[model samples]
Target: MSDTSGALVLFSGGQDSTVCLAWALSRFEHVETVGFDYGQKHAVELRARDEVRRNITARFPQWADRLGEDHMLEMRGFGAVAQSALTADRAIEMTEKGLPSTFVPGRNLVFFVYAAALADRRGLKTMIGGMCETDFSGYPDCRRDTLDAVQTALNLGMEQDFIIETPLMRLTKAETWGLAKSLGGEDLVDLVVRDSHTCYQGDREHFHDWGYGCETCPACELRAKGWNEWVAEGRPTLAA
Candidate 1:
């Protein structure tokens, strides 16, 4: 938070991004969120993003003040080329590379580039995103090395000093749940469970202790497993 102007969060209204948003509010003087509409089949994510933001604002006014402007840019062009279940009408499948069908090529890269542009224009030197290598699908872009390369490329391209923050880069899904608790306690974690959208299927109707999801998609399975393990491990609190 120190030596920074402000922070912009690349929010997806999902479990990880929600935690990142709360994390930013706790540490930064000013924070903003930006989401993408990349023609994903789960369109509810767009509405969920705004809903989660509103809930956070109403519940934590002080933190909400630090949470500044938000953007939900339309990015259907990503679906045009990527053959992923996220943007295509197909069942999730595994690949030889160990990545699932949900893996959207260049999605994270595109997001970072757009986020960098927004941050540069707003004089925000820090950009936060919720990409974790742990407890994540086999998406290569979620790796630390990939993010580092993207950050380097973005800074060199923009000719601006930008700090790309990944608060949950190494954290598990359960650890992320613990992070929410550490940031704002049980209420915050509960809010995340109730408000965040992590389902690849956009199934918000069904709810669970971990979160609302289809419970069958890769994201839901991972989240459920991590949360169950964390709870079994006495629900240990993590440092913010």
Candidate 2:
């Protein structure tokens, strides 16, 4: 049997997290997943998370046994405290603080803390996240430096060595698509396009080749741009 020492992915049911989930499943012997519900405006992604999980288990024979139990944490109060465009009904723009309205203060930090707590309990040593610097809003938590710092803190505080893996930390959105293809092939790519959710507005009514979304929000824009770039490049291999 594969051990829980493999990895735990911080899956948010978005394109990036879904790809990260697949990445973990491909590389790890036993991969578990964790998702958070901070009252996100686009709560539909939570549903998508379940769909994606079921599809991965059913479609990927090689990964069927490697996948393990899933975990969900409810922190709706966090959304109430850290109000942002993502957790609250506010316009997606820049605050005078120079951060995007989607910036849920300390959201990612809390995620690592919570995920690490769970990982410790689950006997997992590695945690994977889709946090990226490229093709992202200026969310400080998603940056590489922030994640590195958090990892150090988690180790120091917990007195246990835990590795936080950000597979898409440096990869652009377009490269992420290529990564999904590389890890799981065209079928995975198709699954991502059809099942993954990324619209910040939570609009699933509007469907685009990239997926269901408002098609104009920041999240949709990024996903569409990546798809367009991939298509233009003949959809060849994209390096990390």
TM-scores, one per candidate: 0.97, 0.96
- What ranges in model 1 sit over 4 Å off? none
- Per-residue lDDT of 106-181 in model 2, one digit per residue for the tens? 9999999999999999889999999999889789999999998999999999997899899898888889999999
- Provide the lDDT at 125 for model 1: 92
Worst lDDT run of 10 residues, candidate 2, spans 1-10
Each candidate: RMSD: 1.1, 2.0
Model 1: pairs clashing at backbone N, Cα or C within 3 Å = none
**Model 1 residue 194 CA deviation in Å:** 0.7
The reply for model 2, stretches above 4 Å from the true place, is 1-4
- Top-lDDT structure, candidate number: 2
Scored against the true structure, residue 31 in model 1 reaches a CA lDDT of 89
Error at 188, model 2, angstroms: 0.3
Model 1 C-alpha lDDT per residue in residues 176-211, reported as the tens digit of each score: 878888898887888888888889999988988898
